[model samples]
Target: MSFRNFTTGQSHGFGGTYLKLVPGEMLVYSDVFDDPNLPGEMTVTVRLTAVSVGTEMTVVQENVPDVIPVEACYLGWQDSLRKLAGLVEPEITG
Candidate 1:
């Protein structure tokens, strides 16, 4: 997917292919950045498990480029997951 940062007016995108998928259980994918500066193929794995209250999800990313700090990548994932939760979780109304 492609994304443009409105604030910085900087744009970059990455393309990924699914390496493995197990329906609702797990998914593995590889991502390659469009920018040459970020030179590396990133492998992302996602796992889903059923719980009494709800589903639990885990994400793991490997082979991240040296240019990006680990903490920054983690923070980015946190923000993205928060946005995802907002979309998937239901609101309780009176």
Candidate 2:
């Protein structure tokens, strides 16, 4: 098992998009395995807690094995965003 802290955000109309991952909490780092009968991709889950607001977000990343080449790693990123969106809440700031 491994952990990583990844944060990403996007705003409409020139607000800009931010995406970054600090590898301080890497939970799993193993050498690439090459086997004839093994899974193609590995799923990684990471949970981050906001220091100031006590908010939590879960980030899921899929490590696509080079052995099994696919189209693109799109679904994995989308799953991460969907998990974070579930924990979003509105706050009053003045």
Candidate 3:
């Protein structure tokens, strides 16, 4: 799926297909980011492990673009995951 960046009005987000998925277990996908400065593609892997109290979700984004700083991406992902966890975890907990 293609995503647009509202801030920059750029279609610099992911546009790809879902490679694999196993409910409550794992997911894999590929995406292309058409960054005007650093266009590239990547594979994203999400793994979920069940714990006694909750599920542990891990995200691995591979094949990063050289123009994009890994540290900035990491921080962005952290914020995204935090928001996602807030949205998803409560449903599972309830």
Candidate 4:
């Protein structure tokens, strides 16, 4: 997937194939950055579980390159998940 930093006008992308998929239950994929500086293949796993209120999601990433800081990666995941929730969750109006 490709992404751009609106604030900095920097853009980059990664592409990978799905290693495993269990529709609505789990997903496993590998990613390789387009930038040569960030050289490494990263594996990502996502799990979903139904809950009382909604679905719970868990994400785990492995083989992240040493160039990227862990905190930045975490914050990026948080931001992405927040945006995802905004898109998937229903809006309530009083």
Best by TM-score: 4
Note the clash tally of each candidate.
0, 3, 0, 0
lDDT, candidates in the order shown: 0.91, 0.46, 0.79, 0.93
lDDT of 3 by residue, 29-85 (tens): 987865556566788999999999988878898987887688967887887889887
lDDT string for model 2 (1-94, tens) is 2223345352211111123445643343222233434344355555566668664656554665664345434554566578776788565599
TM value for model 3: 0.72
What is the clash tally of candidate 3?
Answer: 0
Between prediction 2 and prediction 3, the one with superior TM-score is 3
Q: Which tens-of-lDDT digit does each residue in 1-94 have in candidate 4?
A: 8988788998789999999999999999999999998898999999999999988989999999998889978888999989998999999999
lDDT of 3 at 30: 87
Q: If both were scored by lDDT, which would come out higher, candidate 1 or candidate 2?
A: 1
| lDDT agreement of model 2 with the native | 0.46
**Where is model 2 more than 4 Å wrong at Cα?**
1-63, 67-72, 91-94
Clashes of 1: 0
Assess the local accuracy of residue 92 in candidate 1 as a C-alpha lDDT between 0 and 100.
89
- The order of the candidates by lDDT, greatest first, is 4, 1, 3, 2
What's model 4's lDDT at 32? 97
Model 4 earns a TM-score of 0.86
As for candidate 3, its clashing pairs are none
